[model samples]
Target: MRERTMNLLKLNIVVLIEKYKKVTDVARELQLKQPTVTFHMKSLEEELGVPLFHSRKGRIVLTEAGRALYPYAQKMLSLHNEALRTMEEYKGMGRGTLRVGAEPAVQSLMMPVIADFLKRHPGIRIEVQVEPEQKLKALLMVEEIDAAIIEERAALELPLAFERWNEDEVVLICAADHPWVLLEELDPGQAGQERFVRHAPGSQLDRIGQAWADQHAINLWSPLTAASPEGVCRAVRAGAGVAFFSRKALAGNEANEGGGIRMLKVPGLEDPRLQLGAAYRKEGSPASLINEFVHFLRTCAQI
Candidate 1:
């Protein structure tokens, strides 16, 4: 197959000639020399091995082949202009689209930036997709999203760079009807054999909970396991068991109503182990939107 040699300049010349119908006018509009414009047009016709335009009444006019190529040429020019504008707008202080991913445990923390960013940069759009950490890591590796706010643990195996977004301290909660609800302090040592509803294994919350339990020599039982915060909330509220989550995950949320659930300050609980942060591919060049949003995450100072 013949390699295509068409470029933005040639496409622009064709589009201009179609609109202006004269080499002199086309050159003036493009701010190009008439000879330069003529040369590009001739080269494009040669590259495609087709006659594109001919002189009619001393004005250049599209021939049948040129007419056939008009729509494609126009489209190419439009895309080229759009590409430039998309890249340059943010540098000029305009907002651009930011695609981000996060795990549900940090969804609350991740979502507020969406509103804040759009309010400050009205031209920007932020799309946040919530998924498990493993899936998020996969997406980050492939750059399916620009960045991620996720639970930080052992160094991610993926090629990426990141900054700490938050140190997520786990909060223990139980249904109001649970015996532990009215207590102001939960002694993990006393948790002996008490059941707990937990987020699925491998989740940061689960790991933190396990460590806390181990540190206190507590033998906790998981009568029920959940895959989402909602599931854990539902189970605990139903009196099935207690669970734990980062404070941001439940802040302002009606996790307990009518004494549905109560957060407990577990004594001697290990300090917050889940580190939340923003990460992007090490090799990827982040757009202004990504950089600005990451900055917002760092300075917002609250989840």
Candidate 2:
């Protein structure tokens, strides 16, 4: 009997045919006779109102309809396998919370990863804390957060174990028409002499900028300090000043840059070793949720 809904078996058949390109081969792998496999293909085609495959001499090939369906089919099957794996990996993720601490730079890059994990594990709620590394370390001591993603600049030799995941650069941005925008050789010593717009004071980003200025002995001047990265970039784009931004954040948040912002490479900045890492408490064994979320960070924090 034909099922009213789409069957994974039929989808698998289409996928298998793409690989084997023969009815007998697909039937053998799927543990069905050739005729039964053919019937499934016909039924699947009828339900979709489009042919999934076409025969070329004695070979089978996926048609345009099947080509379009391939990735979705593979994704569905993969998720099914993932569900089984998750079930085996842990007793249950039905109800739990994963508290995550991240700096704004890490948060900008990891938001999608967080979203995707939450979408897959709908039963779990994620509470994200965007704070500096030191504060996050304090939270770890008190067990306020299960995982903390920290920037290298703000990272400290905390009692907790920290694992580096991804590295990104902090770039300087200015209005496209700014005199420094097209310069190939910029002097860090004089960076502080220029007008600047910075992120909110006390933030890791602000701290980075402040520290960089100190290192170069530049008396960095800021006429405006914005509460959000977007605000800082917006001011820079309006020719108010330049600001330091994570390259990853700049890429994902084009709206903040507009067409008037240009990224500048200052001598003292733009190092790749400024990677981000995950930190957690080390005094006691971590809970399963902590371990799971850390694993997620390790895997998805990189491009």
RMSD in order of candidates = 3.8, 15.9
Off by over 4 Å in 2: 1-91, 270-272, 283-286, 301-303
Q: How accurate is candidate 2 locally (lDDT)?
A: 0.77
Give the TM-score (vs. native) of candidate 2: 0.64
How close is every model to the real structure, measured as TM-score?
A: 0.76, 0.64
Output the number of the lDDT-best candidate.
2
User: How high is the lDDT of residue 62 in model 1?
Assistant: 94
What lDDT does candidate 1 reach at residue 1?
A: 78
**What digit string (tens of lDDT, one per residue) describes model 1 on residues 100-199?**
8877677766666678778888887777888777777878777788888876563265567776777766778777677786666667666655788878
Instruction: List the global CA lDDT of all models.
Output: 0.76, 0.77
- Positional deviation of 191 in candidate 1, in angstroms? 1.4
